[model samples]
Each structure stands twice: as structure tokens, then as C-alpha cells.
Target: MKERIRWMALHGFISGVSKLGARRGDPQARLIADPWVRENPGAFADECRKRGSLIRCRAAFLTFDHGVAHEVLRSDDFSVLEQGSNLPRPLRWIAKKTDPGLLHPLRPPSLLSVEPPAHTRYRKLVSSVFTPRAVAALRERVEQTAASLLDDLDGHDAAVVDIVDKYCSRLPVTVIGDILGVPDEDRPRILHFGELGAPSLDIGVSWQQYQQVQAAIAGFNGWLAGHLRELRGAPGEDLMSQIIRASEEGPRLNEEELQALAGLVLAAGFETTVNLLGNGIRMLLDAPEHLETLAARPELWPNAVEEILRLESPVQMTARAAVKDVDVAGMRVQKGETVIIHLAGANRDPNVFPDPHRFDIERDNAGKHLSFSGGRHFCLGAALARAEGEVGLRTFFERFPHARLAGSGSRRDTRVLRGWSSLPITLDARDAAMSSSG
Candidate 1:
């Protein structure tokens, strides 16, 4: 009880300081804590711009300027210390005193939190398996998976189907799971892991949410350990098997690193792809003409997918911490301070993209958007994500060209990710259309 109180007091003090600093009206002191940002991030980004390109939100700096955000992302002066590096001194101490065993188990950071030789090594290991060629080889499987998902929708008696649940949510998990050699019977459990594990990445997860994250990590680790043990002894034609063989052949990953890599692949693969599909469908349905254009010219589906990413990026924001004092966008960001990169805002920057608010599927430069991020931290799964998004969109439109919005959609309650929680859509059945024609 005493430990919990101390922890609460420490967090309360931090929040108090954040609110106090925000009220000063300093040009660099805009608060992103406004709950409204969750619902309308673009508006929040505009507010950040009004304050200055470089502004403070709690302990972090925010930049809506495209150039500044891009530069900070690529800059060696900034690092990803706060996100995935070692836990802070206070948190480490608290965990040590409160739950010693859970402390070490919870503290091992993923690639998102590492730096230097370690980051390079981890990236190389992952890239070896998650290659563009590998993703390309899986294209047929992705297409097949999309068809199966839509076919399930067709079997439903209800005309209005939630695309998020029926297609967007299922396809990516199934694809990633298949690639990882997850057993058919265990697929649902892994999918649940991705769902419950997502909140772990949120900046302001509640106590209950934090507990959920820990539970997910513990559960996943236990499952992965058993799976890896089996794969080590008898390798198969799967990504996990390949990783196990590589670990045995050369520079090896410790048990913790192995588990972390598996979990990363599962969670990251599931979350981003789910959002990409949801966002693309919402955008196309909003402008039915674009869907028609894609259906008519299948070749343009790739460009259409790119434009959707630019307009409604799946991952809205990322952050980097300064390793040393540096001037960015005319503000001196001190060492250990963080800069929040609003990828969605930067994608919409008018100077970088003319008439940015307008969604143009034919926008020639749509490929230049920072949706996949940039520099060293560029998403390793970029090629896979693109392939998934393109194929998923193309197949969906081709299968149900007359699909339309049946009801109001609801957005996910996520501050950093933009996607739909429930997107209700209705597809036209061929028999019904023929009956109506008669």
C-alpha cells in the first residue's frame, strides 16, 4: 500500500508540473494533454504550429513542420532513449522494491528502444528475414487471405458488416501468424495478444492498462519460450524457424532477445496493418469515385494505397530524445528532452504538399509522404505493409465494387494511432442486384 502511494505521488507530481508549465502561455509551452487531441490530432497539430514549430508538451517537444520533423528523425543528435531504452531511475527503483521478479522481466526494451551497435545488430537480424523479396513471395498468400476474409462477409445474413472486424482485423493477423508458423489452433490467442498488448505503447496508459500490458507480455513470453524450444530442435519452413537456425549458426540472440523479437513481429505486424486497411477503406468509401477509378484501372491501386497513407497515416506520431542540447526549429532542446514527431501533420504540410487537405488519389508525389517514417528508424516492415495495404485494398474493391458506407464509423481510442474501431459497411450481393434489375 505504501509503495503504491509513493508511486501515485510521484506521477501526480509529474502531472502537476506538466499542467503548470503548460499554463504559462510560453510559445514553446503548448500542452498536448488536451483530451481533444485524441479525437482530432490534425487540429492539435495546427495548434502546435500556432505555438511554434518547436513546442513543449509535458516533458516532450512537438514539431508540426515537415522539414523539422524529418530532420529531427534523421538527426544523430536525437535518440530513442525514453521509449525503449532502459527504464528511468525512478521506475526502476519502484519496480525493484514493489515487484523484483517482474522488474527484470518487464525492463528488457525492444528494438524501438535501443541504440547504436545493438540497434544495428537487431535490425540486421530482422531485415534478413523480413526482406522485400520475402514479402513479395507472400503476395499470393496475402491475396488468398483477403479473398477468404471477404468470402466470410458474403456468407453473413446481415447486409451491413463491420469491415474492421470482418476483413481489416483478420487479414493481417492471419498473414503474419502464418509467416511466423503459428499453429492454426493458436492463432486466436496470438491475435488477442496483439490487441491487449497495443496499449503498452501508449504514452498515458492507466494503471489497469499497465497491468494488462504486463499480463500480455508474461503470457506471450511463456508461449514463445515453448515454441522456440520446439523450433530449435526441429526447424521448419517458417520465419521463426529461420531465425532459430540463424541464432544457432552464428551470433546468437539470448532467450530474452528472441522472445522480444517474436513479440515485436506479432504486435507491430498486427496493429499497423489493421490501421492501414481501416484507413484506406474509410478514405475510399468517403470518395466512391476513387474506388471506381481503382476498380477500372487495377494498376492504379498501388498509387491509391499510397495516397490513403498520406491522408490518414496509421501511426500518427513518434518521438525522439535529444542526446545533447541542440537548436531545432529555433528552439534549444536540451539533452534527455524529447521531440514528438507528428507524422500525420507533416504529411499534410501545405508547403510539402499543395492543397494538402484535399485527398487526391492521383497525387503524383503521394509516395513522398513520411507515413513509414525516415532515417535509421524507418519501419523495417515498410515493404510488407505496402504489399498488405495495396493487395488488401485492390482485392476488397474488386470483390465488392459496390460496397458503401452503411452507418457512422467509430475511431479507435488511441492517441498515437489513427484507425477505426468499428467501420460498418455494406456490400452489394450479385443476386440481390439481379433481382432488383428484374
Candidate 2:
């Protein structure tokens, strides 16, 4: 354990030196190049376990530059991470000013700075909207969107198409817009605001960006408030309308809760799904055999999506505050200490997953990944995200048949949310036979 700490500290020091533009002999790079890190990530987890229940550090395990403190996120220790003092101080500060009607209610309630009962209450009220039955209803709509988007690329001769921007990113946004009754003309504006609301791991929020985001939040709130008023007078079939009606009954969500719930549904619902689709497609394209295998047997689509979620989880990390000093995964965590749980790391743990680096569509146990998280804080939109992934992949391959990556891919800058900004790929219309087989 002492040697491991020294090794990690040395790696951190090396990373700092490299950042100063002082190139050292390829030691650090060579260390990373060692296959053991990828093939045996469990070694690190095991090392952490041997150290103690929890290791207090001012550094991050995922990246050396980031100051995120690490904590082991296990199903057994979920309660500690959820209600503990692990949430980054900055996020807690944001939670204080956060309008419950926006992002606050979607976060875990009580214990955290978020509203009491409101968060959990609101989540339960609208949970049904994202259930398998509800999300499954969007299949036809999602398929139509994919087909229409792909059809636009029919005449293009480009060998590679940017699936991230062209297909993966667009489908979920459109579908969520339809679910929430956002007007076609207003979808882009709403999407922009949603993107701004994405959680950030940075130490501080830019005042300018914060104000801009607040303005956007105000715009969405105003829109939702007006819609709520209308729903009270004459309810519609949309999820917002349902939420409005649900508020009037027992255990109702207040106006602030309504706004927060709607915004969360709009923001988290689509953003995560878009990344899931983008990452999933990129993974499949990288392994043409996997694509061919799925094309030959569409039954594997569901498991294939699960495998993709495991390999490239959209939500990389979740922050929680420790309510009390507690031991976790072998280290002592002091009260009020912030711990960042790396879902990506846990999902890829070798003990939990065999050959964790390889992308295998047939991996039966892939569903066990913590991509959507676990316990009370688990993603409410898991069903919706999965449905979109399955449908998007099925429709995309059915249409393009022979899509291949066009060039280098770009990723979103946000550390908490892992996704592609752009991924160019080429589609062959002539390979329509591949579509019919599925």
C-alpha cells in the first residue's frame, strides 16, 4: 500500500512537470503504456482497498490536473457516498442558489442542500414518464428521426459521416423535445440552455457563464410556469401536463418543484442519451465485426447497448457529500470531506468485468455496469436512455448498413459528462442489404 501511494504520488508529480512543458524522459508515458493499467485496473482498486477504508487526498484519481477527491463507489458503500460529505463544495454552493424548479429537485434531496422531500417527491411523481413503457412509446418517433437524418446523407459521397453531430446527438434531443412538448422552433434554444445546465467539476463557476445560464434557466422557468398555468386550466398528454396534474393531488410538487423537475427531464434526459448513442455508434463502428454480428442477429441489440454503456458510460462521475465521518473501501473519510465517485472506473473494474478493455457485444454480464448509477440517486431516465440507444442503433445500422468513421473524434469538455462533440463517418447507400437483414 505504501509503495502504491508513492507510485500514485510520483505519477501526480510527473503529470505536474509535464504540464509545465518540461518534458521528462518518457517515464510517465511509458508507465501509462504498460498493459497492466488497462488489463488490470482492479490492481488499483485492490491497492486502494489495502490502504484502508478510505484515502483522503486533495488530488483526483481519474486525472492528475483535476482536484477531485476520490472515493470508492460500491453498491455496499452507496449510502455513505449518497448522503456523505463527499459532494464538492462548489456543487453544494450551487445547490443553495439553485431554483428547485430547475436542476435542484433532480438532485438527491435532504442531507444535500437540495429541497427536502421535494427532490425525492418530484422524482417519484414523474418517474413513470421515463419508465420502459413510456420510453418504448418513443421508438417509432426515434426511428423516424434516425431514418430522416440518414436519408439526408443518401446523396452525399463523403466516405465518412460525423455520426455524433449528424445522427447520435440529434435523435435524443428531438425525442425529448417531443416528450416535453417543446415547439420545433424552440427546440434549439431549449437544447442550448440544457447544455449549459450540465454539471461541471471545475473548481468555480464563471460568473459570466453563471449569469448566462441563470438567464436561460429563467427563460425555461417562465416557459414552464406559463405551461403549468395552462395545464391547470386545460391539461394535455405531455409529461409536463401530467406533472402539473400530479401536483394538485396528495404529495404534490410545488411550483418550484415543477420547474426543477421539468428542467431536469429536459436537460439530463436528452444530454445523457445523446452521448450514449454517439459513444455506442463510435464503439460499434470501430469494431465492424460487432456491427456485422448485430446486423445478422438483431436480438443482440439490447445486450449490445448495455455493453456500450459499460465501455463508455455517459455520466463519468457523481459527487456526494459525507454527512458523517465514515470508513469506505479501506480509508477513513472525515465529515464534510468531498468524495468523487468515478463510475467509469468502477464500471471498468477488472474484478467486476473480465477483459474490461475489450468491447464485446456478447458479454452477458454487461448489464451490471453502474452507468445509470445505483440506489436512490440512480438515473430516473435509465429506461428512456436504453430505449433510445436500442432504437437508435437498430435504425442507424438498418439504414446506413456500411457506415465507417470518417476522421478523428472530438469529446465534450465537461468531465462529468463524457460524450463526443463530433465524430465523422461515411455511409454507403449501396449496402442497403445490410439493413434488410436486421
Task: For each of the candidates, give the backbone clash count.
Answer: 1, 32
Candidate 2 lDDT tens digits, 25-110: 22222223333433333344444434333334443213111112223332223243332123345534443443233433224432
TM-scores of the candidates in the order shown: 0.89, 0.75
The digit string of per-residue lDDT tens for model 1 on 1-438 reads 753443343343343454566577432233324455667666766666777677765456778788998899899998875332333577546645665232122134477777778778777887788777788877878989998988887788876789998899899988888777888788888877667676555543455655676677677777878887877878788887887777667668988787777777777788899999999998888898887777777888888888888878888878788899999987888987878788888988877889887889889899988988888878888888888999998888888888888788998766667788889987875555676689
lDDT for model 1, please: 0.75
* Candidate 1: stretches off by over 4 Å: 1-32, 83-92, 95-108, 429-438
Candidate 2, residue 320: Cα displacement in angstroms equals 2.0
